[model samples]
Structures are given as C-alpha cells and as structure tokens.
Target: MTKSSGADPRKTDVKVSLIGGHRLAGATLHERTVTASLIGGADIDLTDVGIPDGAELRITKLSLIGGVSLRVPRNVRVDVRGLRLGGVKDDGPSEPGGPTVRIDAWGLVGGVSIRRA
Candidate 1:
C-alpha cells in the first residue's frame, strides 16, 4: 500500500506483513502486482475494476505459512497456477470472454482461495 501515493486509489504493489493481516481493496491495480506474507495473510478484492479488453493482469504471490483470499469481479477470466505444498481453491473463470487475470501462487503450508466478487 505504500506505493499507492495518490488520490486515485491506484495500487502497483503492496507491503508484506509478517505477523498480521493485510487488506487491499477498492483500488485500480496495475498490470502486474505482487503480494507476499510470512506468517500472516492477505485479502485482495478487485470489484468493479475496469480492465481493457483482451488485456492481462498478472498477480504473483509468495506465502510461507499464511494464506491469501482473492475476490474478483464476474466479468473476467481467471488463470491460476503455481507450486505449493498447501492447497488452492479456485472457483474458475467467471465469464467466457473477458479480460484475463493470471495468478502465480507459490507457497508452503498455506492456501489460496479465489472466488467471484
């Protein structure tokens, strides 16, 4: 959240939390975003955000013993992949034709939950 130094609520990156939780929501995100946590967790919400047609939004995650919960709008396609020792629960893509969101989640002893907003 430190990189979002404007009144537009646009976020390019988020600070990692070690022993607490971080919530990033209601912001216009960049094409690429990164989030990580050591012993905490993060909650990301992207609702009513506009993404260009055929554009791709990439989100990379790194978690050690934490988890991440992501909520996306219903008009985008989601592609999730990674290497993890935990688990991932994806609700799959929303619509057939829309913007693409690629998520790369790499973690150990944590989980990722993705669902519609």
Candidate 2:
C-alpha cells in the first residue's frame, strides 16, 4: 500500500524489504541492479517487479510465500533460491539467445514460467 526508495544510486546493488500486510502491485524497477537478495513474505504480493532492458539482476536468495513475478528483458541473468512460485502465470513471450537467463529455485515454483523477453 505504501512505497519508498533508497538513496543509493549506483546501479550495482539494491535491496528491497517488505513486511507486515504490505502488498505491492504493478511496480517497475529500472536500470538499478540488485546483487544478491529478493525477500518476500505471505503478506506481500510482488506481482510486478520489472527490470529494464540489459540490466543485471541477481537474486541469490529468494523467499516468496505469497507470490512474486519478475519481468526481465532478454539476455539478463537471474538466479533464485528457496522461492515459492506456485501462483504465477505464464503470460510473457520467450527470450532469445538460448536461455541466457538462468534460474536456481530451491523451494516451490510450481506454475511459474521463466520465459524470454
């Protein structure tokens, strides 16, 4: 329901934290690269976390209990761990270049599709 942005602006690393009955929808994060963590909870529904074209976003640890959807451009590398993506829908086009995007999910990503572009 409420949003806030950090003061750091280097496009190298970013951190997002959501807690306690906060739901985020249709939000976009561009040109800023996140290095190692994407944490979510049951009270948070990150249905729209989009990265710009040619931006590098790495999620070393992802803990999603409610839901999280990431819309990434083609050729961007993605890594996920301990994600529960059982409620995500496949509604995007496939990215080219032979799966240049890589995903590593350890928890439960049931119906989510990591398509290209």
Candidate 3:
C-alpha cells in the first residue's frame, strides 16, 4: 500500500499493487483517487467514504494485466470509461442525481468490476 497525496491529503493517489493485491477500507476518502496496478489486482471499497452531494468522485485506474474491483456506496451514479483489451463491468446504482463516481480506466489486458455496496 503506497500512498501519495495532492495538495489535499484527502484527495489521494493510491498505488494499489505492483504484482499482488491490495484493499482499501476503514478511512475517509475524498473527491478523487488515482490508482494503478500491474500483473496483480486491487479491491477498492468506497462505500464508507464521504462524497459531497452532486460532486463527482474521480477514480483514475491505470492497470495492465490485472483486475480492479470497486465497491461504491448506494444512491450514486457510476460512469466508467476507458480503453481496454478485456472486460469492464459496472453493476452500480443507476439512480439519477446525487453524487457521481467517474471511473477513467486504461488497461491492456485485465478486468474491472464496479458494484454497489
């Protein structure tokens, strides 16, 4: 678990894994998170975090040959976009209005799954 922060530590850059797996929980996250992986995976649960109303929480995923499983809170909109050579699934909420989570992901060969928690 390697972490770096922006001007605000709440808005963080989380390196999930290099060749294994990592999990994120039990913390107060902010509006944005940047994550990456290579030949491994990451499980990110954002259900317990605080996202401002109508604000968009950006999750930028840079991964290759690995998987990223994301669990978001309820009543939020999830938008996933990227270029990938594998599967990307989003089983999140579809309600209109409220907080939004934008996932920008890019990978050569892997999978990304986003679900509600």
The number of the candidate with the highest lDDT is 1
lDDT of 1 by residue, 1-117 (tens): 123446644455656766676676635466667777777666778776777668777777777776778888888787878877767787865878888878787777667888886
lDDT of 3 by residue, 1-117 (tens): 223255555656566767766666626444566767776666778787666677777777777776678887777788878887767787754677887877777778767887887
Off by over 4 Å in 1: 1-14, 26-28
Per-model lDDT: 0.72, 0.36, 0.70
Model 1: how far residue 42 lies from native, Å: 2.2
TM-score rank order: 1, 3, 2
lDDT of 3 at 115: 84
If scored against the real structure, what TM-score would every candidate get? 0.76, 0.34, 0.75
Q: Between 1 and 2, whose lDDT is larger? A: 1
Candidate 1 lDDT (Cα, whole model)?
0.72
- CA RMSD per model (angstroms): 4.3, 7.6, 3.9
In terms of TM-score, which candidate is strongest?
A: 1
- Candidate 3 wrongly placed segments (more than 4 Å): 1-11, 26-28
lDDT of 2 by residue, 7-91 (tens): 6444333344543212323243223323222334222122334434444433322334323344444544444444554644545
Steric clash pairs (candidate 1): none
- What lDDT score goes with residue 108 in model 1? 77
lDDT of 1 at 89: 84
